[model samples]
Every structure is written in C-alpha cells, then in structure tokens.
Target: MTAPRTLLDKLWAAHEILRREDGVSLLWVDRHLVHEGSHHGFAKLAARGLKVAEPDLTFAVVDHYAPTRDRAHITDPQIARMIDTLRTNAKAQGLRIYDLTDPEQGIVHVIGPEQGLTLPGLLVNCGDSHTSTHGAFGALAFGIGATEVAHVLATQTVWQRKPRAMRITVEGTLAPGVSAKDIALGWIAALGTDGAQGHAVEYAGSAIRGLSMEGRMTLCNLSIEGGARFGMIAPDQTTFEYLENRPNAPKGAAWEQACADWAALTSDPDATFEREVKFDARDIAPTVTWGTSPEQALPITARIPDPDTVTPAKADAARAALDYMGLTAGQALEGTPIDQVFIGSCTNGRIEDLRAAAAVLKGRKARVPGLISPGSAQVKAQAEAEGLDQIFTQAGLEWAASGCSMCVGMNGDLVGEGMRCASSTNRNFRGRQGRGARTHLMSPAMVAAAAVTGALTDVRPLMNGRAA
Candidate 1:
C-alpha cells in the first residue's frame, strides 16, 4: 500500500497544475480573495492589457482602510480613489465583490467561509497575512505578494513549493482562563518567532477538536506569527455542522455530498511528518506578549524573561523589542499600565468575541480608553439587538461600526507614540498598531479586564483563574 499523506499533501497533489522539471510544483488556486491592497495588481495587469483570467475564482473586498467611525464619505482622496478603483476593477473583470454597502461585506477571511466561499481541499490565496484563517475550514490557504497576486489572477495558478508538515498535537483539555489565543501565544512563545519556519502546521489531538470554529480561526489567524506559512485542521463533522445550514452553504443533498467529500480529506493515520510537537493544554496560561513579536510572550501569571539567560541572538531580539516597547526585563507582565484597550479585528471581531467582551464588561466600566468594533455589519446589528452595545458603552467603551478599526492603523484609528494598548487584534509587531505604538495582544475578555483595570493584569483572576 502507498504511504499515507496529510490533507495538505492530498489537496496539493489533487490540484497540481504541472511539475517543473527542476522539481518545483505549480498549484491551481481554487479561490483568490483580494482586498484593496491587490487593486494595484489588477492595475498592473490592466496596464499590460490583460484581464483577470479566472474571474469566477476571484473575490474582492474593501475593508482594510474603510472608515468605520463615521462611515461618511471617504474624504481622504487616496482611500476614496482606492475604494473606487476596486469596485471598477471587479466590475471590469466580471469578478464577484462584496461591496462595502453589501450586507455580506466584511473582512475577506471572515466573509469567505461565512458565505461558504471557502471549502475543503481548496488552495486559496489572498494578499493579506491572515489568509490562513481559511485553513480552519479545511482549505490550504496562504498569503501572496502583489506580483504573485497578479500572476494568480492572470492564470488561476501559481508556483508553490511544498511546505514540510509539522503535527502539533495538543493533548488533554484546556485549563480555566485558557483560550485559543492563549494556546497560540503559548506555542509561539515556546517556539520563539520561527519555531514553525518553512512548515505547514497541522494542529490536532483531543484539545483542538474541542475548540469552536471561532477558536480555530483565532489559532490559525496567527500561524504566520509563529513563522509558519499556515496551519490547518481537517474538515470533519464539526466543519460540516458549522456550514450545513448557513445561507450560502450547499443545501440538503448537496451538503451531504460535500460532507462525504470532506470526510475523505483528512490525513491518513500513518502519515509522516517532518516534525512533531506535543503540549498539554493545562500547561498553557492566559498568555500576553510583552514585546513586539508574538513569540515575546509569557504567561500572564509569569514574570518577563531575563535577557541575560537568553543566547546572544535571542538577547538581541529581546533588547530590540524592549527598546521599541520601552520595557525592562524581569518585570511582572501583569501590572504594566495600558493606555488603551481595543477589541476588534479579523482575528477576534466576530460576534462570539463581542459576547465574550460584553460578558466581562457587563456592569464594569473601563477606566481607560476603550473601543469595540464588530467584524461585520450583521454582527453589529446582532450585538446591538442583544444590547451588547449598551454593555460596552455602559462599561465605557465606544461602540463603533464595523471595519478594520484599530486592527490596522490605515483607518485613522491609532495608538499614539509611547501609549500601550491591550488589544485583541493579532499582530503585535513593531509599529503594527501605529508608529511607536506598544501593543500587548490578548483575548477579548482579557482586553476587557485591562480596560477596567487599566493595567496588564491576569484575566484568569477575573474569571477565577479558570477558562470562562
């Protein structure tokens, strides 16, 4: 019998476009999700008198720099022009678009699976780093540069080398106060910034199976932070269950057939891996990043690492992060002051995240500045109807319309120089939130705790040192 292979290998093999005699493999893209960033790619193609060769497989959205605070006319000429350009380009190419005005419009990664546009065995690409979020739905997704975006748009294909597989088997159950965010942070912390370098991670084992779709998305969203191209979980009954009755999902018989196909997509039991890691979920704490990189994280209950103990290279990274963040080693991660608390992004802006934050802020008030933006207009309305907006406002948080807000500084929401922010967004890289901004990435509830407490305290204490 032939040796077993992972779902990634199986899908890539199935979608193989052609093999280069030199050993590189070409991959057929099943979905090409684009954003305002890739409009330039379309322009480049049009400049050469080329059209989107596969309009049916391409999708465009305008969320990255879309204004969320006012939703009024985009006064910034550059942003307005960019938005118009995308609309024109999508129309010109006959590609489907979830326009800003469309009820379905949202972060590309969020709307894609919500609309059943992302599916198992598909090779997906976007021009944004978090495209890995789609992998939670059992697809092989990765981000591409503008040049590569143009190539994919021109041919519905692109060259890709196979990534080595790493099976990260998380066992047992997560302890109290632990979340997928914590798990992701824990792994990144353990592996440093490059633990999963040049590899595709398959997060498996009992603990992962128990995570909700939102949790899975959170885990996969930060795969790149761990130096991984992406991470994935096979589409199982849980996946089918999430999509079976969605408005855009296949109906009845079609869904059954789709489920059957997805069932065949998992890695075989005997599959081999280039590397494997194991972790006990209980060992993970409510983690928070102390410095610029996600890997510069420590459990909230733990103290920051001493720079002296690390190797020279690690010491340099630690020093750079500290200098940029203005922090000293060996300090408690829990009591640092926060200037702002932001809860909204493709990573944690979903309705579930809102509920989690609302739960923590129910009768509490944020002593510091706070903001909450839902992932989509639909989520906004749902949250408003539930009076979640009231909870946030009563807790001293600004209830705003949905868009990338604070998740990316392009929307004009920024954390000023020397101001530390407790955020639920993914990246905490240098100047990620804004120029000279210091961001400590955590979960929604954790952000709420920071908002109320005005300090980097362990959220486990609020939830009674347990996962809520």
Candidate 2:
C-alpha cells in the first residue's frame, strides 16, 4: 500500500524534472510574473544573448514604480525609465505586459488571480517577495531573486530546494470585527516571525476554509512576514467561483476538466506534515501591530508589551522597535494618534477590502488625511460602479488609482518622516512605508476607523455605531 502524499509532495513530483544529489531539483514554472524591477533580469538575458523560453507563460506589470495618484504622467525620471525599460523588454520577448494605462494594470500579486493567470496545482514565481500571494489559489508560488528570474525567463524552469511542509489549522468561527488580517497578525504574534522558517505553510481547518478568496489572498500574502517562502490553501468552491469568469481562466469543457483536477489537489487525509500547529478562531481578536515587526501584534484592546517582559533573546529587538516607533511599552494602543491612514496594498487592496473600508467610512468624515487605492483598474472601476469610491471621497479620503502606492515608499506617495500611519498593508518594519515613518498595521476596517477617529480605534464598536 502507498503512503498518503501531501499537496506539496504531489506538486513537487508533478513538475520536478530531475532531483540532484545536492538537494536541488529542476522544476517547471507554469507562470512567471514580472514587474518594473525585473529589468535587471532582462538585462542579464540580453547580456547572455538569450531569449525567453516561453514568452506566452510570462506576464509583466508596472506596479512598484507606477504613480497611483496620476495616471497621465509619471513625474519621476528614474521610475519612468524603469517602466519604459520593462515595456521594451516585454515587447522584445513577446510577453504580455500590463502597461501603466492598461485597464488590467495593478499590483502584480493582485492582478494574477483576478485575471485567472494564477491557478490551482501550478508553479508561480515573481521578482517580488509577496509573490506567495498567488499561493492562495493552491499553487506552489514563491519569490525568486534577480538571477533566478533570468534563469526562469531563459528556460521556463527553476532550480529549487524543496521545503519542509507545515500545516496551520484554525478551527471555530471568527468573532465579529475580526478579519483575515487580524487572524494573520495573531498567528504571527503567537508563532513569532521565524516560526515557519524553511517551511511551506498550508493554512487549513474550518476558519481558513470559511474565508473568501480575497481573504485567503490576504492570509497567504503575509506568509513571507512569517518567514515562510510559500503559503497555500486547498482549492475549493470559493476558489472556483472566483476564477469562473476571469479573463484568463479556462472556458467551457476545459473549465470542467480543470475543476475536476483541482478537486483532487487536496492533501490526503492521512498525509503527514513535518510540523503542525492549531489555533482556535474564537480566541483571535481584531489585532494591530504595535512595533516594527508584524509579530509584535496585539489585540486592539490590549496594551503594548513591556519590553522587559519579553524573553532575553527578543528583549533588545522589542526595545529597539518601541524606540523607533516612539511608543512606550505597556501603553494602550487604542487612541494612539495617527497622522495618516492608508487603505490599500497587495495584501488588502481587493474589492472586498474596499467594501469593508467603505462600510466603515460611509456617512462619516475622516479626522485624518487618508488615501484609498484599489488593487487593480478593474477593482477601481468596480468600486466606482458600486459607489465605494463615492463613500470614501464623501468621508474626506482621497480616492486614488490602482498601484502599490504608499505600501512601499518607492512611488511618489509616502508618509513623511516621524509621521504615524494606520495602514492596511502588510509588513510594519521600520522604514517599510517611508523613511522614519511609523506604521501600525491593521485591517481595512480598522484603517477606516482610525481615519475617522484620528487614532488607532477598535473597529468593532464603530461597526455597531456610526462613526463620530
């Protein structure tokens, strides 16, 4: 009798061409996502006089350096050059490129699944760290370095070292006001940042299954924050429904066959994992990060940790984070002032995330300057069609076009030095949003609540009552 195989094992076996004695294997890549930064890879290819092995399987987008506020003009000379270079490279390689003005343009991670370019039981790679976001669809997706990118572009395959498998199961139902962002923050807090190091984490159990495809993307998006290179969930009805009418999704008979194949992609019941962890969904609360690290998260109602109370190994880092954030240990996180509120990123820039923020901002004005950027042009159009943009603008928040925006400081949008921002984007590391900027990471609703209140406010109460 054969032993049960894990989803990771199955995926690895399916694409693996040869396993070397040095623990490296050549694996076929199903999708290659490229961004402006990928110009380096293209330059390498040019230097070597090489052409893309499979241009049809590669996709490009202008996200990192694209301006979210101005669609007509990109003012930064360096950024404009990078965008132009990417366009030139894509054209030369005959790869599909979503230019800045393309209706399909958006953050690479956000557009992949939305367009159905990401699918179950496939291998996806990108030049950006959040490429694991595609893994939400049950794909074996992860980020690769510039050199690796050139190799994939040249041969449509990657030399990889297989990672150990870990399963994180969340049971029970989430309480009201709690979101996928909160669940992710709570998990990072409980397990610490490096808990999943060298592992591919598969999120499972009732609570994870209950989340929508967007929510699952938010969960998997932060896999890197937990020090995991890959994260995934088994494809199910929710996954299929989301991909049904997408632009690149299978059609007619192919759709039916795809569904059948996806249905069989789940891990066997008796499959064993290298590591396993469990959490009760009911125990999680609306969470927010208090320090530079995502793992420094706590419930909105809880106080910041006193650095001295942390273990010796973590105490120094905790102190450093508090000092950098200008936060005092043991202080209440609620009511902490924020200079800005940003509600978008690959992590929480989906239409559902916009709806949640809009729900909180409706009929109320923001107490602080706020910006809202949709995940893609389609998502932006959808939000406008649904009047979500009106709701945000009515609440005194700037409705911006789709791009990475303030999530990374590369683009024109940024929080000034020493300014505090309540952000929905992942990664609260110091200077992640801007130089000398302090970021508090939360869900879209929480960011909306903070915008309305000018502080880090719990979204649960605001959900029950109109914003004041």
The root-mean-square deviation over C-alpha atoms between each candidate and the true structure, in angstroms, is: 1.6, 1.4
Candidates in order, TM-scores: namely 0.97, 0.98
lDDT of 2 by residue, 1-468 (tens): 888988889888889999999989999999999999998899999999999999999999999988987667777898888889999999999999998889999999999999999999899999988998988999999999999999999999999999999999999998878889988999899989998999999999999999999999999999999999999999999999999989999999999999999998889999999999999999998999999999999999999898899999999999999999999988899999999999999999999999999989999999999889899999999999999999999899999988898999678788889999999999888898889999999999999999989999999988985421
Going through the candidates in the order shown, the clash numbers are 6, 0
Clashing pairs in 2: none
Top TM-score hit: 2
Q: Where does candidate 1 clash, by residue pair?
A: 176-466, 176-467, 177-466, 177-467, 334-456, 460-465
**Alpha carbon deviation, residue 418, candidate 1 (Å):** 1.0
Q: Give the TM-score comparing model 1 with the true structure, all chains together.
A: 0.97
lDDT assessment of candidate 1: 0.85
- Model 1: CA > 4 A from native: 464-467
Stretch of 10 with least lDDT, candidate 2: 459-468
